[model samples]
Target: MKSTIAFLLTLTATLLSHLPTPSDAFVYPKTPISNTVWKPEQDVTISWHDDKHAPLLSSSPIFDIFLMTGADDKQKKLATIASNVDGGTTTSVKYHVPHVSPPGQIYFLMFQTKDGSGMAWATRFTITDSEGNPGTLRPVIPEGGTINPGGIGAIISSSAKHRKSSAAAAKPAAAFADRTATAAGAHAPVKAANAPAASVGGGNTQEENVVVGGASSHKESSALKASAGGLMAVAAVVVISGLQFLGF
Candidate 1:
């Protein structure tokens, strides 16, 4: 009896192996999660568009939210919400983010079917203030300022101050040029006084040399002419004395 029972169990195991394993029946949606943002400390009501997913997902499919923390796609169960599908009607669902999640921490939201065998989707986001939001849909600063601390108003103020300073720097330099020209003009007389001393000293020295040479030349010429006239008179007197001594 024991041998017969063992033979029957072996036959059943072999037959089951030959048969095909049942495939998973659920279909996953390919709709992307859009309009993602972050809110610090406050309850982050995370939501996404689910209208396109109505056809693939069950009419009342239950959602399982998973946050992929660290490596290996390890799922950290976060929250779950029910999908709204009313005969092809479009709708959305929300999941509240934990307040303890610090700023700039990477997190992923994975929407999966309850059976864990349907088409799964995941989108990444970071917790941050509005100004400091990361990822593709980051917050935009205002026209004149930056995000103040974490809001749009601070951004506007920062931008305004930046523009004001830039405008002041960009003003025309004409006024500065005029002031420089005026200062240069005022110093022109001082420059002339410092320059003329060397020129005047050279001119006076040359004039003194010319005057001394002229006076010395005039005195030497007059002395030479007087000596020549005295020699002629002495010669005439000597000749008259010789004639008288000879009694001729």
Candidate 2:
């Protein structure tokens, strides 16, 4: 009984030890995306080549290819490009990765041989640009936000001045009504008419300047986000190859 058990144990260990190692000479093209902005209409291809000198994976030599895509926060396997290959000299596989959102990575896999081997290689490519869509829109800043205090004050003063100037430029009848309304709002004893008019004029000038300042902030923020996303996509491609040899 002891001898029989030892023989079985040796057989199991031999089978485990013969597991295939991912060879280093395998090569795949840098996967290409139809667009980088990642809209629903884009298509991408992921392809790879095997070294001719590498060991034939099995008696029949076959591969099963799979594609998985990442979008909107998660990775899901895409169904349209999954298949098994059995023939000679199959150095490449093509996968069409799907995109439905703004950010995504397309990953490709080839399981070596037809016996359901655990060994496989995978690489991720990124989709960029929306199809014919101009791209991410520039956002507008809300008025009266706290970006610039002095500039904000200047804008408010400028708007007030414009309103007063328009009233002054009008005929005397409109001017008197405007001054009368200002006087009625002043709870304290009314100041000199000229002094009150100057103060009201300055306020209108300030408000106009504030509106212009709001526009600049949005352009700056969106640019920063797009630039960062591009860098991350590049890094993913470079790092993913290292993991490919690990068979994960």
Candidate 3:
């Protein structure tokens, strides 16, 4: 009987381990999306709908947002607006567009991590430098403000490294769905139905939060959690059956 119980518990645990983690629901915010044309230097805030995953990273994961150009059935990387971003070290990261970027048609925001895994959102926008009066596009800084010059180089360097590493295969952009939310407690994890497609870069695009302790250890920790849950369930069932058999 003990052996039987043990086998059932093991099986249950194994099954549960395969269940999805919170990271599966993690995504960029859907609300307040912009389709504005801007200049080379601008500020764009990367927003995510899943709040619980805001802080769970192996290290502060760097997000590099880029503009992808499609030609000859191959997608070429254009300008990089944001790089090496920690996302406010909280949930949202404010990124400044680099001066190296030029005026062009923007598809949308496509970002990848250091490991090459990424998500891309399809959008219709433009990047231009003409003044407001006769121009259809918007300046990065409409107020004519300036960004801190110090950090731009570091961001650029990191982006270059990423480019080199993934030079072999650059997947065409995917349809990254926008999930909207305000804060950490706003939306429940499982409630999220849409997530960005994983066709862009690498890793589990559905990958959830630091809760499972980043992407590397996610599988192991999920298995552990499953084992624990299985044990509890089996113990409960056995106790109940035994109590019924006793019949007071």
Candidate 4:
């Protein structure tokens, strides 16, 4: 019985350790808006959060930010700006709109992250002249006439190059959903439920690290509960075995 108890305790510990750990990575927090009338020759700020102790970005991997006009993947490139900005996604990049930029209803933003992950992101907003006049009139601008027609769309990160999003007002895509679309897309961000155990990799993986923060708090709780249940079961079995040994 003592040996069995010892083994069970070890097993519980092992199972607990197998829980998911999120890997170190970067994420976009405040990407450029998809449908706002930005001013020409204005500064647009894009920011992100960096969890991994990644050093400040430097040279080597090139970061590209460009503007496109039109909706969806059919956007036409209006300008391409190549840079080597050295801050991780945590740092905000203030892109200067060209004074000669033409006003349009579809102003799409496509920028590749500087991090080696090669995470590409696309966002959209309306383009208006410096006086806040949209080149093309949208049916409905937000209450103050600045937020553009649609709400923000969903957030997107891809490995593909030249990925772009709809420049149309946010009204159509998520229009039927009642709630306005947000950055990236019209749908809500995906939450991990019933996630599988993470693979072992020197104890450093996104699944493993997620326990420490972010949307995976529930996962951590479930893992702890499972480990507790396993311990309880082991205890029950050990008690029953001891009773049998004593002829109870």
lDDT of 4: 0.37
Point out the higher-scoring one by TM-score: 2 or 4.
Answer: 4
Alpha-carbon runs more than 4 Å astray in model 3: 1-26, 29-34, 51-62, 71-73, 87-90, 98-105, 132-248
Q: What is the lDDT of candidate 2?
A: 0.29
Candidate number of the best lDDT: 4
At residue 42, what lDDT does model 1 achieve? 38
TM-score for all models, in order of appearance: 0.31, 0.31, 0.33, 0.36
- List the candidate 4 regions with Cα displacement exceeding 4 Å: 1-31, 50-62, 87-90, 99-102, 113-117, 137-248
lDDT of each: 0.28, 0.29, 0.34, 0.37
Ranking by lDDT: 4, 3, 2, 1
Query: Residue 147 deviation, candidate 2, in Å?
Result: 40
RMSD of each: 54.7, 31.0, 18.0, 16.7
Off by over 4 Å in 2: 1-46, 52-60, 69-76, 87-89, 93-97, 106-112, 128-248
Worst window of 10 by summed lDDT in candidate 4:
203-212
Cα lDDT, model 3, residue 53: 54
> On residues 1-248, what C-alpha lDDT tens digit does candidate 1 reach at each position?
45644554455443333221112122232222223444532344433344333324435444333332211111232323233222223234333343212223233434444433332333334544333443222222234431111111111122333233222222232211221111111111111212111110100100000000000111122322333334344444454454454453
